[model samples]
Target: MSTSAPASLTGRTVLVANPSADLYGSDRMMLEAVRGLLKQNSRVIATCSRTGPLVDRLQELGVTVHITEVPVIRKSMLSPRGMLNLARIVMSTFPRMRRLIGAARADIVIANTLTLPFWTLAARSCRRPIIVYVHEAESSLSRAARTLLTAPLGLADGVVFNSETSRIACKAQALERRGKVRVVLNGVQGPATSRPPRDHIEGPARLLFVGRLSPRKGPDLIIDAAALLRSMGIAVTVDLVGDVFPGYEWYEDQLRARVRELHLEGVVRFRGFQSPVWEAIDGADMMIVPSRGDESFGNVVIESLLSARPVIVADHTGLREAASGFESAVRVAPDDPKAVADAVRRVLEDWGHFRAVAMVEAVVAQARLGTDRFHEGFGRAVEELDR
Candidate 1:
């Protein structure tokens, strides 16, 4: 009962302004969007703040890459000095962005995330149709802070919320009323075939936590949960996959120190960030997404489900939205190591039942949250802007 994707954009050009060049959840989503546009014969020009693997991939795909400094709004940039720096970056890059859009004769512009508010304004000044892709659901933020972040979406011709949670958190009801909003739940592709969950729960249970190693993502919580599980005579080895941001090295250090403090030296391993995380997910019996803060949607949770792996997620925001209705998925209280431990314990006790359920859910997830759906939804968003 779904409508077809819009017609081809043969003669149109798209300019995608993304905040980072890293291959994280949002960054990977951006890549898929670019691919979808190319399939429709739209010329794509991508702009990244810094150079990384994503930029390389774009060029390899024959998409023009424009390296520029993109002003990203973060919690650290809320102070006077931070605000001043943001202002300076805006002053320097705004005109250049507008000029790039005009020079490329871009018919449409897409700001990959709300972090790049400057891109929205630049596209507006260029008189190009712009779509803002909202990826974060900051229910934890103060109302004013949320407003400041979402204010630039006013200039966008269309707003694409990755999930309904994101739309509500951004207070985009007004935009929805104007028919400028589309909630396109992320479409993620897993391995070519679903990997079955481990047959036998022998030795220690393999637990995997994948995401940015930040306080909000709660890598520390995984360590605590592992410690608790071990204390209860449960043999478990925890693998913390993913890395920290440039300035958040301290968080990683704190995690290692906590592991040492808990004397979980050999039990806990830091795998850093792994691209194409299928092998890691396949190796683990279960995956955990313990975000202590707001998430627009749970790409990792979907990945785990698609891999036929049971997932233990913090029950709130998009995590709940993603993990709900699947028997293989377990929800625990956010920021509570005991809750995580208990959930893991329960799953271990009934491993056979959970694994069977995971195999079934993998097929359902593939049909519902697969890459094809994502590409079609992304195409529809652009087509709506064309109207």
Candidate 2:
């Protein structure tokens, strides 16, 4: 790729490769980035391994969609049988992926996650400018996984990271110091106005957790915290509003069993995945993000702030960065149920003050993470490819 300005994106075609079709944090962020590209009058062709609501939603946005067998290499897929199956999928898909790139005649290729290094390989074959948008933090990856993931990053023309935390991690492990790296903080469509105020705070406090039900996300930690609060004579209701990932059904079963063991049937409720998650955030008095692993960026934390709800998040990796500027956010040690319960108690102890602070923080967060800023950063990253 030449480092001189070539052309504008007004008529340029872009191919976006996403690892999964499910609408989680990274998927939603990818959608937002695609929307930004469309606004620039660029033509887009998006690819995913499977069909889901995200694929349908992309089509609705006027982007051409390709459903391919782009198998993601995860830690779980490192076993002997798993590795064999992965190799078969990759071998079968590689040629087809290269053909798709050629057929699309894409001027730019954007691999939207670290898990899809194969997309980088295919894009290289097509001689298109490759930009890898990394959404995972380093602390989350094992040493072997880090090496495996970073190995192909040298092929990228430009790298987009969602946060400074992720940028530092990637540079330290995968990327060259001179690599073209851009830190584009993820943005959300801020709520029109602060959510309606709660009528009373003297009753049972409602807490919300809205992400995947996995060990990394620490949903079980929330349940344990709820039990602890109950034991201390505090009436609290915890609403878990996300489903377990595919192949993680056993984790959900474990969570349910733990809930039963703790006799917290009434205190904790599993309200599977909810769309327009703001509605769920609005219904709760506070939002909790008890992640036990590294998060590249916590979109849910900003969403809660935008909804004028106080947040209690695990103080780790990019999570600390996400909750940094908001006075309404309380940070607790990761995987510490007692710390979670204590933070919750502190927020509720002075509920009125915290509510007011949350409203103010919402205003600050909106200005920092507005759609215009996100679009500008995204546009600049793409435009850099032509230079």
Task: Please identify model 2 stretches exceeding 4 Å from their true place.
Answer: 1-7, 78-85, 172-176, 192-194
- Give per-residue CA lDDT, model 1, range 1-387, as digits (tens): 354435547768899988999999899999989887886778899999888989988998999999888778997676557777888879987888888898888989999998998888888887888899889898887776777778888888989889989988888766788888888889897797655787989999999999999999998988999999988999999999899999999999999999999999999999998988998998899999999999989999999999999999999999999987888889999999999999999999999999999999999999999888888778877788668
What does candidate 2's lDDT look like per residue over 213-267, in tens digits? 9998999999999999998889999999999988999999999999999998888
Write down the TM-score for model 2. Answer: 0.94
Top TM-score prediction, candidate number:
1
Query: Whole-model Cα lDDT per candidate?
Result: 0.88, 0.86
